[model samples]
Target chain A: MQVVALSCGNGGKEAQDFIHKVFMPHLQGFLTAEGEDAGVFEARGALALSTDSFVVDPPIFKGGDIGKLCVCGSANDVAMQGAHPEYLSVGFILEEGLEVALLQEILASMQAQLRLGGLKLLSLDTKVVPKGCVDQIFINTTALGPVLYPHLSAKNLKEGQVIIVSGAIGTHGAVLFSQRAEIQLDTPLVSDCQQLYPLLEPVFQSGCKLHALRDATRGGLASVLHEWAQSSGVGIEVEEDCIPILEGVRGVCEILGLEPFMLANEGVCVLCVEAKDARQVCALLQEGGAKKACVIGEVVAGRGVTLKTPWGSKRPLDILEGELLPRIC
Target chain B: MQVVALSCGNGGKEAQDFIHKVFMPHLQGFLTAEGEDAGVFEARGALALSTDSFVVDPPIFKGGDIGKLCVCGSANDVAMQGAHPEYLSVGFILEEGLEVALLQEILASMQAQLRLGGLKLLSLDTKVVPKGCVDQIFINTTALGPVLYPHLSAKNLKEGQVIIVSGAIGTHGAVLFSQRAEIQLDTPLVSDCQQLYPLLEPVFQSGCKLHALRDATRGGLASVLHEWAQSSGVGIEVEEDCIPILEGVRGVCEILGLEPFMLANEGVCVLCVEAKDARQVCALLQEGGAKKACVIGEVVAGRGVTLKTPWGSKRPLDILEGELLPRIC
Candidate 1:
């Protein structure tokens, strides 16, 4: 049971050995610069850059680990800007005594995710703190890419635009909640932790009039709608039945007394497009592997998000206020 | 005293409030993209990218805090590549109970450092973990800039090249060591934590036939020499009397039984230049504010580093093998 030591992060021989023996083998193909102060790459156009830090407890989860989350999370942010995530810079903060095996597993996961997304690893850094200074591990990633479609912003949402959700929501949050030490439920729920760029690639190529694009991650669909409403100064009305949710996720949400709309989703995204292109965008997303893609709502000439119930009632969907779950990402 | 709460990182209204109230006020002038998923910037040439995570214990230190260190550290890495650092993306992992005022102070420091470097804040992310999951805070910064001088690498060192240190070494390490809880030694030494680009600007403009350039950071002068020796398959020999060391730093090193050369320096840089241009380069550095800049060593046709003593004896200078100090950066 090899464990990480303080010497591994001291920028000495031990650290170099750790990088060559442990990290390089896993990240061999993706890394372009091995021992330089910085990595050099050509960037010849408008670039979209995003940064994220993943501190999720129980770093390794049912569907993915923190390493995979770090890569996919930042990639998704870049993709939401109508860009193909091209390169990444990663930083790791490891707690001393963390199992080397666990770190290897996480690194392998990150490598796989990077390969899937066609992202090059430009630079990397590691820092080890004493035990109890941090959890087992935390990962920070910065994703950069060239923008394909410009001016896709939350403020672009207009009154006649329609909202489309790529897939089912809340599975990631539900899975994380069930995996908590206090509530280790025996369910077959896996997180929807994945990259969304591939699914959005065809849509970007199709020349659809994309008004706004965003992945519903931490505060989920509800938060995205509220933000869109506020940013664009428009009202959002969503059909309760039109929102997609898995049975297992709904069950966990019911058991925990949580709102499915407010739960996190890694793979799901909410997009706003012209009303005429709604069907085409949904079809494209479904063909690109988002089987549950559908139009969930539309924008109106008011403010705030509203949920239209099947029983002929409406309720305002407020932005998440109190803490629902910490380290949900 | 308000403290960061879990909800402050939940990507909800509370998170928005925290960003607007706590972070934005300090970082207002630097941040160009405020509410977008990713920041879009123009990158029209070869770019140097670097990433680093700062977890220095005692977030606030004698010379600088973790916030300022994060900014300067990444910026210096980019600058080492002969790049003028232009943009930065920052990620913060905060403990749930960390004081908001302390975080504000850290952000202010970061803002000041970014201003000093003329670097724009492109993107930012914050993640708050539960109490005890992390120390007070950890910051990750990714810096990017257009490469001005290409092909400056450790592998470029060759025989007949001379090594010039930018300033006195080991002050940063000594300052951090004296501030440790176990060793609260009363010392006036301050961490040499600063951005090196401004000082290097004139040298870059002069174009004095540079071979290799690196900031002696984590593992200090010894580590840099050893790396350059191994990378270029050349031998390096430095005179002990020629190496500049502050009296206070030398005193602390003697008391702690640590090699001054193995101690870290944040603001100092080691440069390999043509032997003929060494004197001019040193003069340029001195004129640019590195008052102690001097030729400390020269490259030879062999391997490893050797230290020449004033008593007419030579000894092998090994790379730092064990942990000298943890979290010195």
Candidate 2:
């Protein structure tokens, strides 16, 4: 089987041949500037630029791979700023002796995600390190897009703003944790890794005033809430039973003693809108295929996040404090 | 000494503490968007976007480290496109056991470079992998700049154009190779790693109608010439004696059986200008501190690069065919 060699990343004939023969075919139409040191494009407005590096172990996960996660993660970050992602700059660090077929599969996955999000690949770079210098692969993607709605800051959250979650949380984190720990479940669990722009586009178009928007990524839903509470100096009160968690994911969380709220979610986004527009925004997200979209909490005139248990007890929801999982993306 | 722990990158309270206590102090004023997922900025006119991942082994070398190289390399790529780098999005992938003090030093280096280049840190992401998953650290920098001079491309090279090198070649590659191979040299060698924008700014202001501009990185002088020749379908003939090589670097190259032309340079740039403007461009670069700036070759009506020896023999210079030195950048 063909595998990547150190020479492929040497920036010589071998590197050129590798790019042309292996990468270009999969990303032919999306790449705007293939050979230039940098890609030049026209930009004339307020732009949101976000970057993320994906180092998920077992690069190929249940429902997605590192390639898709890299693209989706950055795109979602940009989209959370109420922007329409338009371009991407990606850098790939590969380990020598990695299977060429696996690399191709990842590239193809990235291409598919780019097409889905209507983002053009503006610039790309690839480097190969010796075996064991890096995990199988690590991808860093920087995304840029024009802002459709301005002033979507966590500081904009006011008391009485409703918090809505686009979908079930913790699936992505649960799937990766299970895969790494070799834990099997009665029901298969897939990551909720996907682009968020398409789902959020209609809300932006509806002219709804979004106080704050954030994808519950690394530190998950609880982290986003805590940040919003701290940044806006407001209290976030959520009903524990109202937050959606998949059955299998809940089982995994129970088995692993992981809090579902603290687990990562690539496709789930937390939104804060005025109470008056809460239902409308949730409806728009649901129409955009976020079937589980619903309002779960509200911004109150206090500090920190509080969870109201179904059994009539309230507890503070602090940010994640320890390492839950490494390289969960 | 405190070292990077897996929890520091978990995007939780510890991650926040790490950023606020460690990273933010070093990068206080330069970071535009500290807490936001992505930074929002106004960009107008044509823009150049470039990305590069620096995995230079040892992380720290004689004259520079991965932090400085990451900043300079991406900024130089944008500058080569006749753009003034204005913003950067950096992603740091750190190993679990990396020394926090070393990371602080690297961040300081990055801040220094950013200040030197007059660039702002727009967005940043940090991820920590488990031990052995990554070599100490790898940094990915994505640079964005406004295009000051448009239409500078490798395809713009034409017959009769003269090639001007900003400085000596092969120092970076030689330094890295010697360090990795543990070769003892009588004379110490340092990498020629610096921001090229400052040196080339005067040339852009001169309005010399530059045909092409490229940093002689990765595969070095020979690779740049080969790319230009193939892209513009012209022949480049260089006088061997005209190409500048530091004495210490030349000795290292001879001992290692490596061609200096194929070695990498971080700070050096190769510019293609009209024959009439070659001397003026060289003067401007020399005035800007590239004291070794000189004309090394000229474009001709043929294909590939030819090296004319001082002994009166001509030989073709091919693109680097194999791995000369990995992670030289």
Candidate 3:
């Protein structure tokens, strides 16, 4: 039972050994664990910065673990601003007695993800708390990157602009729910936990009029649409049929009596682009590995978000409220 | 007792309302809580970046709360790199049933601390977890700043460099211990929780040859000294009697059989300066409110750290190992 002891994060010798043995090998370019309190880096030009703390239950999940989620979460946030995710600072709050092997596995996953976008891990802090003080582990990540396009903003959205979803929605929320419920099923659901910077890089370089981009995360696609509508002071009508939903996600949502529209996403993003560039942007997204990218709806006068069914019926889509699932990241 | 419900972090209408009523009033200038996935900022030139997650037990202490600790902890790290602490992103993980009033109080403390450095709260993420999952509250902060001096590093230390203690040490650790133990001491000790940027700005601007700077946190002064000596492949000799330790902190350490050198510091920093410029740097620090700043040691040709006692005896000051105190931040 090679587990991390309380002394490792006591800011002492054990912590230094853990960094040398576990973290430093993976964080080659990052100046973390350098005995210095902070990591030094160089950045030039306009930058987008974002921070996220991942407290996902069951540190390890199917297809991905908390480590991948941590990277994707912050990197995606920067990418949503049309920035290339470049550098990140990571802080870990580990529960005492956690297995060393588990921590290593998560770090490997993080390294793999960082390599995808050529992102560098710049700084790290590992704090080990007493048992029962925290769950297994919580990771906080802050990402900084040069802004590729300065014009992208929700406030820039206007009437006639269209919305495009990068991929299938609600897979992350559904997979976590099913895993927690322990409902043994043959479908074998996996979380859609992947980096989106690669997917969006081509679209950003395509010279398309990207108005506003947001990762459909906690509040799902509906939440993002509602926010954009409210911020832009315009109504957004997303067609129910055009929105893509995976069969596994749909099945899990159906059994759990959850609305796929309100489910969280880890890898999907909603793009509000000028109406003329909608088709070209979708094509670029699809070419860049966003297989299901397509125009879902358009902006209109008024406020709030509305969903129209295939039969032409329309109704308001409210924001998801309350704890859908605690520690869902 | 108006406590924050789990719904406050569920990314719903309730979370939105909570942000509008509680966070927005205080978070002026930043476009956070705007429903976007991340906040955008402008930056150029070399940037210093750092992150820390504060999980101090007893979130509120005599001089500051976790919020203030969160901001100072990260800002100090960036400042230690000779950078101007500029933009910060905050993430709060709240336990269900935690009082909203306490949360607000902590945020107020954070706001006050930020005002000291002219730092902006650029982004914020509030996640509410189920009760028993977390202990009240844990805050994670990430800071970014322009590199004011690019040559400052632990590796820059050389022989004949004098080390200066910015102020009295060990008060923070002593205060936390007393409060946790519920001891009725005649002297009421407070945490040295102020930001360090203001104190160091003068020294940096005075054109002193600042070799290396480190805030003596966690494993305290001993840890920092050991790290600097080993990193620079040099030995450091300190006069034990010359180190500034407050009377109250000395009392607490003596009563608890602890070494003041091993106790953590929240606001103090240690500087390694060229021997010729030590006096001028110390004078500037004292003028800038670090009244007790003085030469404690000098870097030498050997390795490790040695403390010379007032009795004309020398002994090794090994790295602080084991659990000094958990959640001391």
Shift of residue B181 alpha carbon in model 2, Å:
5.1
Tell me the tens digit of each residue's lDDT in model 2 across B48-77: 999999999879988999999999999999
Model 3 root mean square deviation, Cα atoms: 1.6
Which residue pairs show backbone clashes in model 3?
B235-B302
lDDT of 1 by residue, B1-329 (tens): 39999889988999999999999988879986889989999989899999999998789999999999999999999999999999999999999999999999999999899889999988999999999999999999999999888889989988889999999999999999989998998899999999999998888889688988999998999999999999888999999999999999999999999899999998999999999999999999999889999999899988889999999899998788878878887
Each prediction's total of clashing residue pairs, residues at least 3 apart in sequence or on different chains, is 1, 0, 1
Worst 10 residues of 3 chain B by lDDT: B28-37
Give stretches of model 1 more than 4 Å off. Answer: none
| Candidate 2 CAPRI grade | high
Model 2 C-alpha RMSD vs. true structure (Å) is 1.1
Query: After best superposition, candidate 2 residue A159: deviation in angstroms?
Result: 1.2
Model 1 lDDT at residue B183? 92
Q: Mind sharing the TM-score for model 1?
A: 0.99
lDDT for model 3: 0.85
Off by over 4 Å in 3: A29-33, A181-186, B29-33, B181-186
Worst 10 residues of 2 chain A by lDDT: A178-187
As for candidate 1, its clashing pairs are: A235-A302
What lDDT does candidate 3 reach at residue B262? 84
Q: Residue-wise lDDT of candidate 3 within B262-329, one digit each (tens)?
A: 88899999999999999999999999889999999999888889999999999999787889788898
